[model samples]
Target: MDTEEKSNQLELETALNNQTLYWQANLKLLVKLLVVWFAVSFGCGIILVDWLDQFTIAGFKLGFWFAQQGAIYVFVALIFVYARQMKILDRQFDVGDDDSNQEPQS
Candidate 1:
């Protein structure tokens, strides 16, 4: 291949590699967040209910709280956490919004 063609090919490979890495990181974050959500919602709310019920929080059984309110609260928190983390990830991967790159108005 000519020098220019080889350069373009190298750039394409680098871009593909970066895209793969970005997706891997995104999936890793998603899986971790989902695990935390599952652990709190299912594990604490169901499987460990008996064990957690032994404790009280604000006069409510811990397990009951998880089953009733805690899971919803945790899910909401996770939404915000996901947004924030994705923002950071986008910035790290150079995939964030680029207003400056937009075409100028006619």
Candidate 2:
């Protein structure tokens, strides 16, 4: 009932809301990245291989390329994508390390 108590409660609620938003953003990013990985690894490499085989790239069948190398390439690229996204998220959430940005005191 005291003003001080109410202010503390509001601050706590705001912090909780921010934390929740950060988590939701993180989960969404994870799910999107996973979907991309799955699509590249499973869909292109296996499910659509036959259909994709109809195309060729520099004497290599598209499906064979997807199965043997394309998926791995995509996976590596996805790793970079995830890292970049997480870095952005970390900054947005104010969770990123700040020591590197601080000036040393004399």
lDDT of 1 by residue, 32-105 (tens): 99999999989999999999999999999999999999999999999999999988887787766757433222
**Residue-by-residue lDDT tens digits, candidate 2, 1-106:** 6999999999778877877998999899989999999898799999999999999998888988999999999899988998899888777867665675432322
In every candidate, how many clashes are there? Answer: 0, 0
- List clashing residue pairs in candidate 1: none
> Any runs in candidate 1 off by more than 4 Å, and if so which?
98-106
Worst 10 residues of 1 by lDDT: 97-106
Error of 1 at 4 (Å): 0.8
Highest TM-score model number? 1
Q: Which stretches of candidate 2 lie over 4 Å from their true place?
A: 100-106
lDDT of 1: 0.88
